[model samples]
Target chain A: MSDMRDMFVETASRLFRDYCTPDLLRAAAAGSFQTQLWDAMVEAGLTKAAVAEDAGGSGAELADALALLVPAGANAVPAPLAETLIAGFLLGEAGVVVPDAPLTIAIPRPGETLRAVRKGDGWLITGAVARVPYARFASGGVTVIAETAEGPLLAQVALADCKIAEAANLAHEPRDDVAFNEAPAQAAKLTTRQAADVYAMAAAARSAQMAGALQTVLQLSVQYALERSQFGKPLGKFQAIQHNLATLAGQAAAATAAADAAIAHAEHGAGSIAIASAKARAGEAASIACNIAHQVHGAIGFTAEHALHFSTQRLWSWRDEFGNDAFWELKLGDQAVAAGADGLWAMLTAAA
Target chain B: MEALSFAPPPVSEEAERVRAEVRAFLKTELANRPPFKKADSWNGADPAFSRKMGAKGWIAMTWPKQYGGHERSALERYVVLEEMLAAGAPVAAHWIADRQSGPLILKAGTEEQKQSILPRIAAGDCYFCIGMSEPDTGSDLASVRTKAVKADGGWVVNGTKVWTTGAHIAHYMILLCRTAEPTANRHEGLTQMLVDLKATDGVQINPIYDLAGQHHFNEVVFRDAFIPDSAVLGKPGDGWKQVTSELALERSGPERFLSSFTLLVELVRALGPDPSPAAKIAIGRLVAHIYTLRRLSRSVAGMLQRGDDPAIQAALVKDLGALVEQEIPEIARQLIAAEPDTKSTSDFVAVLAHTVLNAPSFSLRGGTREILRGMIARGLGLR
Candidate 1:
């Protein structure tokens, strides 16, 4: 294995083994307590992995840094890792100073729009950004704003600069809608396209996280099968259970490969096709694996006492975080056919 | 299970030249051949064409030159297979023999067997069939009831094997039979033997038509069929192990799921430009699936090259690849304006027709979807 994949496996395994317990997942989901796992991750320099060395980070490659977050999704470790790491990397790349605390970003719904107008010495942003993850805890946010003359622009605003209304999702991730009522903010150097690109990258990372969570759930289900016995032998020995695990393993493998490819593409400047492909595949695979894991684990998998739900729940949440399967599928389809048959052939063979 | 990190380094210029040479050979050979003809490639099973390939020293390319082989690298062999499949060559005649049986005998057969059989197989003058599946035993080889009782100098075999592809045309079969008394454990006491189809007495091969109305498969029954001790592959009780190893070869190839590739190419050609949104979406999803399957399949190949069984990985590929291939026809039906006609002369239409006809067997042939999922679960340590 490459050092990068090894790092990913090791980091992900640790979170599943140590912090992402059933109790921890329940606490995080119930909004009752914050798991210290987030602090531990930051202490381990995971959150700042993609941040530049100049910005008090390891300055690792964006893909490598993003890999660390996959396990977080698998374990459903409630933290601001995705938001903070991505925000930190973008800020660091643009020579902006990110706070020591975590940061996240939010976009308006697909049809909605946000506007940022120039005022006095700063920019005044007025819009509502929904489905913002880790908004309650993030110290700052990177918001997408559309300007009448400039097209689209990404701006960074402190949490104190905007109003946050707590929001809850089906998968138990913390979310909120942020309404900026003429909130003053500094303009990020990245253009709308750049911001979109960054968002796609983050979405790819989120997919990786979902992949990781699915893997964890698979592991848990397999473990359960071995210990849970019927008909004088463990269920793991049965062909039925074997087939389910095999399918899940394939799904997990697909998720990993797709996410890795996406990361590689992003690192090499391959553009949206790579990200779209990864997000789409990861979304589908994660959803399938999550459902299968719960099904295989049966009643236990659904209970709060079993840690399987911790990972599976996160898989469910992260798959929709950046871009859902439907969204990325359309994006990839448009680009692929638009490139024409020859273009599609080139892309397919080019990977070889 | 690990991500594919190291590429096989880079091929030398000479190696690249060799690949180009092979490509040139294929181009010349297939210039006048319709693209749809290439769709069946190896699976198309034309003996004459296979003989021509053998004449080019393509069959058993990795074997030593002394045994009618070219002593090429496995990677070189892989290139040939890929090119052949991509071009849709009719390689079925020598496919099994060249792929596994020849290789297996090379590894475990006696000097006499190698001298008599390997050369003929390399020449593509002889064909081989698998005698593993039985009426009682589907893919669960351990449950096989084909008895090969010990005799003075040989053995007497009696059993019925169903769904045996190319039985009527094959010269010999790699048979798995019960040699010893049935042990408490199902996988034990079985053996593999090379049965001569020409000399075997009381053996009947009956054609079994597939859904496509193709007589490509058969049910072969052996009654007191005799096989000398030398014909045995490896030792008794090794059949289970050997067959399991053989599956890595059987399941890992591009053929496991590429059966629908011709249809995909045809669909693209038929759709042309400015495809409807629905068509584009379907194609996009299919392409993504194909891409993912290729990567997974490549990883399995890498594992095999490194001397790893990767049975679980192979099963994973087969399950997913089958699904992807099976989905192609449905997607094509929705995307294209005209209904597929299997008997059509048009290359795209014909390939699509063939794929639609053959798609159901995709999940059923190698191992049923249910069977594969069970294996995957086991590999994941699930019950």
Candidate 2:
């Protein structure tokens, strides 16, 4: 186990240092998503790293997948690679014939209704899903739908079946509103509960990404503190900046640890306890990391020219992407209470 | 550098069985003990109970059997520590010697020292206290002015150690004092000596009552105290190295954080089935932080087992863990209404009282927040 963790640390460090350099992050922020980097990850088997080997990919565990994503996040890579990989894996896990291409899952907005009806050989998906991340770039999409008789279902629909309207999220990710009008779709074997489970897992993965991004921002901020001089010394020489960076480092470490633990639990079928915990911690940490990086960088971090904006912006977006910190917090608390006193004690003791 | 990744090592079957055994022990032996009471676990220090644990070979599970040690793996020891702390057992009596002093002596002490001390410590028949801090030198150990002069195969030590927990009851103290001349470097010429507490020759232990009127802490003065050269831990001038390594053990552990865990459990219980939104949020945040800290701490333990001293990482865990623990009381206060009178004997309320009283020491003990942050910043290369 120690070796595995060390391997993760080694892999993550290399990815961040060599691939997710400041220039690369800046390019990502400027919408110059590196196709070479994406392709390199794919060739390195990182894209479908969590999928079973039987499904034409490395059967890496969830932790391994998360380990890869952390660096992807720290670099603020603009491609929706994480989302695509997750959507593909879920579809493949459910025995769906995942297309040999990138896929993205669109989160259903409040008041949005997705209805599916049986057709001759497939189903017709009707309704609009809002805030679909990387919708325009996906070859297909995995969307949530409510069926009248069959209940909640996750269906895989080709991008050709839906219209992707150009949209920009707060963090400048290329999102879009996916509008489906009786589009032909194939229902995967995933139920509504399973879909919710998948959503939670995806949220956990995205949280890992956010954690990675936050860690990067922290490192960058620390580096800036060392390089930038104040009164006769590096800015880092000041206790105030030192304290700020320490706090940020603590938060980043906490978030990273939480995400890793969550992935471990999820892989072992531990349910929402782990996912909710990771999501909550990562969400909060990402927001704080962004704020701290900007604060430490001062005016330079806020400017468009600095690379810090790349990670900071991604931190803001990824935090809200999978579910905000508040949402996950509620989920975790409700789950704990539902487990009752004895259950809570058992869980705490087990963790301890 | 590879991508940032965290894949915990797999748990062994023996470790799993050990965890079960410890769990069973807690359920049976510690069933009646309140969770909050168990919060201190070993730090709660009841001599009789600690002696019982020693008898059961639970005190020094990982030590060599020849020296009254169990010679278990660090992971197995880790399991035991986690179980004991989770159950909130009274382990305070033997915690110090079992944790550091005994280990230090085993590694650096002469065969005679090990033969004399290890068995007693393993038996929980002896206790030890840290004698490092002075009135003027808080976090700055090199700034210590306590003097120890060589005198015919022995040393004459004279100094005052303040904020020493368990000083009143400890049988001995592992004192770090200046053994040579003060020089340009603050870390030069120091030594760790084991001083017997029962000696009335020139030592005085005075109680320093805390805000809660608790006498858990004391100030000990050693005037003309004689200590044989054999009493020194490691080589003379190795005190700085020994002390720094000891701090890693001190700062990183389940105890550094989770001090107020009993209250957190109580708060959840008090909330019942349906909790307010605010309460839910607070509890969720707390649990998340706890989970995160546990992983980080565990990883540090893994590092230690591999012969690595993760001082910076340990400091990071301690600083963050302390803050999370300190916040529990405040969050609990806002979540649950205060029962002014003794209307409720709920475990939650009792745990709250205990945590509120102890929270201040979370950051103060081991190392102050200011000192820890400085270390962390330096670790990050900020300074």
Output the number of the lDDT-best candidate: 2
List, residue by residue over B162-250, the lDDT tens digit for candidate 2.
99889888998999999999888778899898888986478999999987667788999988988988888889888888888888888
Chain A TM-score for each candidate, in the given order? Answer: 0.90, 0.87
Chain B fold agreement for model 2, TM-score: 0.94
Q: Candidate 1 lDDT, tens digit per residue, A1-352?
A: 3585567558655855597776777777888436377677777677788888888886778777777766676667677777777777767776787666777866555665678877776677888877788788776565443453566566787788888898877667778888888877765553544435656767777877876776677677777778888899887787766766677777888877777667666643325566677777887887788777887788877876766766766667677877777777776566666666435644554554
B1-383 in candidate 1: lDDT tens per residue?
23212122233344455557777887777788775666666558788888888888889887767677778765567667766776567888889998888888887788888888988888989899998888879867688998988998989999998888888889999999899888788888989999898877878999999877888789999988888898998988888888888877878677776787767767777777777777777777766676666666766666666676777677778888898888888887777656677668777777777777777888987777787777666555453
lDDT of 2 by residue, A46-153 (tens): 667667788776666666666667777776766776776676666666666655456788655446677778777677888887778778777656545445467766
- Could you give the interface RMSD of each candidate, to one decimal? 3.7, 3.1
Error of 1 at B350 (Å): 3.8
